[model samples]
Target: MEPDFPLRKIIHVDMDAFYASVEQLDNPDLRGKPIAVGGSSQRGVVSAASYEARKFGVRSAMSSVIAKRNCPELIFVKANFERYKEISKAIRQIFYDYTDLVEPLSLDEAYLDVTINKKGNPSATLVAQEIRQRIFDELQLTASAGISINKFIAKVASDYNKPNGQKTVNPEEVIQFLEDLEIRKFYGVGKVTAEKMYKLGIFTGRDLKTKSLEFLDQKFGKSGNHYYHVVRGIHTSEVKPHRIPKSVGAERTFSENLSSEIFMLERLEHIAQELERRLKKSKIAGKTITLKIKYSDFSLQTRSKTLPYFISDKDLILETAKNLLYQNSLENSVRLLGISLANLNTERKETINGEKEVSVQLKFDF
Candidate 1:
């Protein structure tokens, strides 16, 4: 195995139950009760669930109907993305005060490259504590931080102590820490990969390390090398601060799977409307329209088409999605439907005669 890579301090900060916590913080009655933030209908899904709700097997992305069935007393609340975005901006400002090398994974989680911070603090653990404390002091919300030599390890460590806590794995401990971790705990090992690993008798990092690179490559393809290297404390992915999203999409999972082609158009229209809202909000358009379907049996498929011009119109998106949906016969009762736009035309803000202009609205390149 390769020797441990050069030391670089990275910190991963994640807010615990951000949306549900915000609801509890804003409303007095929800403080200590199980709550879910999302639509509470036959077709609605949970965007986030509080820890209390989780005890009854409630989880984000779960059908609201099932969540209610799991916890009869679970309270449902609407998601307030606008308020969440405001708080997210405030938290990002705090991150900026430390370093410009901050990569936000979402509204609630980010990774920071703190090898050389503005505070001139040598210890990453101390820096994480100070950041967490400041977030609570200013925003009235708690965050957990994980400090380690790289982003991968830091991300995993941050989850070690959740809900307003911090954990640090120094350079010397990186190897042992990884060796003792379960295969399921690895960052990229999802349900499918874990099952594949189990079939190969690889249940832990130590088991993974025992396999030869050639064998792993045959078993898991490109990800085989990724697993081998990361187990030996060798993840080289840098903290990317200005990463742009490649595509924008939304999907809805229903309480009951849909089988009829006639009833599918209504769901497709709803998803198209959401895609339109997102496209406009992001100030971008795309030429490619893609449709994703997840079958009741847990299989998935996608079909896409590229248009002659970029579009953000709901009618056009709905028609395109409708075409993709009907292009093939219904494979199975579909549990989820998703629509997305790719090959984006994201505009940049520019100053024109002292007035900022959106490049797309002018219909010309600068």
Candidate 2:
């Protein structure tokens, strides 16, 4: 920790059981019962489950079939992405009211740098409370808030109390708060990584702080340095605003693999249309069109072509992707097809000669 390092006031806000809570809010009947938002089909994945559903071993990303087996009384509802998006925008507007320094991790979670807030509220904890209250009153949603000196500590504090709760970790309490934390509770430490740390006798933050930086780096590569600092309540990452679009893409795995070029072309066209819509929304055009294919045996291939002039035309993108696909000539049945537009531009430029000259280049890897 460097002296004179400006003390940052960071707040991490996380919506509680976002999807399921939204479902419950819309329907009075679902308020107290276990609810999950996803298809009930055998191949369906659980996108979100309520706390009630979680008690029965239900979890996000679990197979719906398995969730049903675990809790026979589980109620499954279709996912409403549009509704979630609308709510997410509303919540974001509230964040902007306080500070422009907002970084969204997802629709349900964000980190806000409120070191210099609009309200001139000296206490970060009060700011967190006010924001949480505003979210509930305005959006009818419950959010958990954590206020700390840095992003890492703030994120952990938010989870300390969930479902419309808040926790503040002041500078004096930072070290003790981290020292007692479970190794698994540390950000970026997954199950396998936690197990490895445990094997090294590092089960708590104190255990982690005891290790030398060189030793930890030797064990965990680049991320070891991060872990070394976070255990001591040190983090320097700033909350960056959402970046402008550089690429737009969509990919899907087929239920049954198809070897037919016609079927693949149809799928590619659909993905191209999706990309076109996103590009139009962002007011961006890209010069590179990329085609990605995955075979039934799990082998993958990518083909890309870069045009001299950026374009957002769906027809042009689809045609270029189709040509790239044929050029790659599949040797096996294709299980997945994806198309992407990259190397974006905000506006087009013209030469003095009044000629719309453009260059195109292709790159591929087998």
lDDT (0 to 1) per candidate: 0.85, 0.83
Candidate of highest TM-score: 1
Return the TM-score for each candidate structure: 0.84, 0.75
Candidate 1 C-alpha lDDT tens digits along 173-269 = 7778887999999997999999999999999888997988788889998787778777777766778797567789988877788999777888888
- Residue-pair clashes, model 1: 0
Compared with the true structure, the alpha-carbon lDDT of candidate 2 equals 0.83
lDDT computed for candidate 1: 0.85
Off by over 4 Å in 1: 1-6, 41-43, 252-263, 266-270, 280-288, 294-301, 304-320, 331-336, 342-366
Off by over 4 Å in 2: 1-4, 243-249, 253-269, 272-276, 283-366
Candidate 2 residue-wise lDDT at 109: 95
- Give residue 53's error in model 2 in angstroms: 1.1
For model 2, residues 193-261, the per-residue Cα lDDT tens digits are: 999998999999989988887898899987777787777666767787864555778776676688999
